[model samples]
Target: MSTKRQLAQQLGVVVGFDDPQAALEQYRTPPAVASHLIHLADLNDDLDGRTVVDLGCGTGMLALGGALRGATRVIGVDIDPGPLETARENRRRVGTKTAVSWLRADATQVPLCPDEPVTAVMNPPFGAQTGNEHADRAFLGTAADIADVSYSIHNEGSVDFVEAFAEDNDGTVTAAYQSSFDLPRQFEFHDADSRTIDIELFRIEWA
Candidate 1:
C-alpha cells in the first residue's frame, strides 16, 4: 500500500478550476486532503475493483485517486463543462489505466445506476454562499441512493448532522475524522493569499 503522503504527491499534478464559481464554492481540493480521504477509503476496502463515483469531481482529484488505487471503473460527475474538460486532461496527465468516464451533469442528481457495489467519494460544496445552505445534504442524498458506501468532506462541526441524516436514511456512520482544507485565494471574497479551513471526513455505509 502506498503511504498517504505519497498519494498526495502523486496528485499534486492535478489542476484546479480555471474559472471558479463562488456560488458553487469551487476550490481545488488540496492534494493532502484528497489523499487522506481516498487513502482511508482504500484501506477500508472500498476502492479495489469497485465502481467509484466522484460527485462534483472538480478537475478529477478524488476521481483520479480512485483510479490510481485500482477502482475497476470511475465516474467523474460535475455540473460544469469547464472542469470536466480539465479533468479529462488530468486523466491523461496521471496516465492511469483504470477507465474513467467524465460526465458533465449535476452531481447531486447524478445520472448513474450501477448494479455492482459502488463507492462514492466527494469534497462537495460547503455552502458558504448565500442561499446555498445544506448543499452537502443533496450530495449525501444521492450517495445514499446510489452507493453502498460513501466518503465525504464537510465543515468541521457536521458530525451531528451527518449522523442524524445517516440514521434517518438507514445508513451508518462508520467513520469520522477531522482534516484541513487548503484554499488558495481564487475568488473575490478572499482576504488572503491562502487559508486553511478545518474540515471533517465521514464514511457512511448505506443499507
Candidate 2:
C-alpha cells in the first residue's frame, strides 16, 4: 500500500468528514480516491513530466499523488480557502518532489491555458443535496473547454447525467471506473449510518 493509503487506513480517514476544517487541520487524506487517482495518472500514458490540474483538490490527495507519481507540475485548485490552506501545509509536510502549486478560485470560472495540452482531474460535488444537474454539467463543460483530457468523479447513478454533459460539450468518454466511497457520518444527511456510496470516475476527451 502507498504511504498515504496506510496512513488513511490507520486513521480511519474517509471522504467528507464531519468537520472538514478540523479534518484538514489534522491532515486527513482520502485513500481510496487517492489510489484511484494514481491509477488514472498512470493510465494517462502521457503523465510523465506532464502538467496536471486538480479541481476541488481536497487535502491535496490527488495533487500530491500526482506529484509523487512523476507529474512535472501539479496545480490544485479549490474554492474553499480552508482546504486550500490545508493542502499547502500538507505539500510542505510531504516535501513532494514534483512542483506542486495551489490556487483558490472558482472551479467553474478559473482561467486555463487553452492552447497548451493539459490533463484535468476533479472530484466535484455530487449535487445530491440540491439535485442541481446544472452545477455538475457546468463543471464538466468548463473542464472540456480548458483541457484536452479530463477525469471527473461523481455518484454512480450519475452516468446518464455525465453522458448528457459530455454530449452537450461534444466530448467522449474515454474510460470510467466504478468504486465505493466511504463518507463520514457527519457529512451525510441520513442518520448516523455508514455512508458508503458507489462512485464513478470518468475519463473524457473532446469529441
Candidate 3:
C-alpha cells in the first residue's frame, strides 16, 4: 500500500492543463482515485498480459498506473494536446519500457488493434458543460465497441443512465465503487478553490 501511494504521488507531480477546455470537460482524475482503480484492476488480473487503453487520459495517470502494474501494453488517447504533452513527460519519468502508446485522438474515434483484446479505463467527461452534455456516452459507446472489459467513472446522479447505456451495448455492470472526485479550480469561473463530486466507478464486461 505504501508503494502504491508513492506511485500515485509520483504520477501526480506532473501538472495538468493550464487552460482546460470546458467543451472537452477536462478535469484530471485525482491521484487517489487513479490508484484505487488501478489496484482493483490488478486484483482482477486485468493489468497483466493485457492491452489497456486510457480514454481521455489526462496526464496519463490511469495509463501509466496500468503500465507500472505490469500491463503488457497500454495506450492513452486524448483529444487535447496540452495534456498529452504532459503525459509523455510523465511516461519518461516513470521509466518503463512497456510499449505505452500515446495518441492525440478523440476517445470516441481511437482505433483498437485487431490481434489484442483490449481493456479500457477512463474518467470521461461528466457532460456538465453546456455543449458537452451526455459526452460520456460517446466514450462509453466507443469502449463497448472496442474493449472486452471497461472501467469508467461517472457522475453519481447518472447511475441509471449509465446502467441503461451499458445494457443497451450488450454490457453488464459487474462491479461498482463509489467515491468523491476532486475538481480543483482550473478555470476562472468564480468558484471555490476545490470541490468534490460524487462519482461511481463502474466495471463492465462486454458480451
Considering every candidate listed, which one attains the maximal TM-score? 1
What lDDT tens digits, residue by residue, belong to model 1 across residues 1-207?
A: 678998898899999999999988988888899999999999999999799999999899999999988899999999999999999999998888899999999988887888999999999998888899989999999999999999999998999999999999999999999988767888877999998899999999999
Worst 10 residues of 2 by lDDT: 10-19
Q: For model 3, how does the per-residue alpha-carbon lDDT over 20-100 read when each residue is reduced to its tens digit?
A: 887787877787888888888888887888899999998898998888888899999998888998899888887878898
lDDT of each: 0.93, 0.68, 0.85
Judging by TM-score, tell me the better candidate of 2 and 3.
3
Model 1 residue runs over 4 Å out of place are none
* Predicted structure 2: lDDT: 0.68
Decoy 2 TM-score against native: 0.82
Total clashes, candidate 2? 0
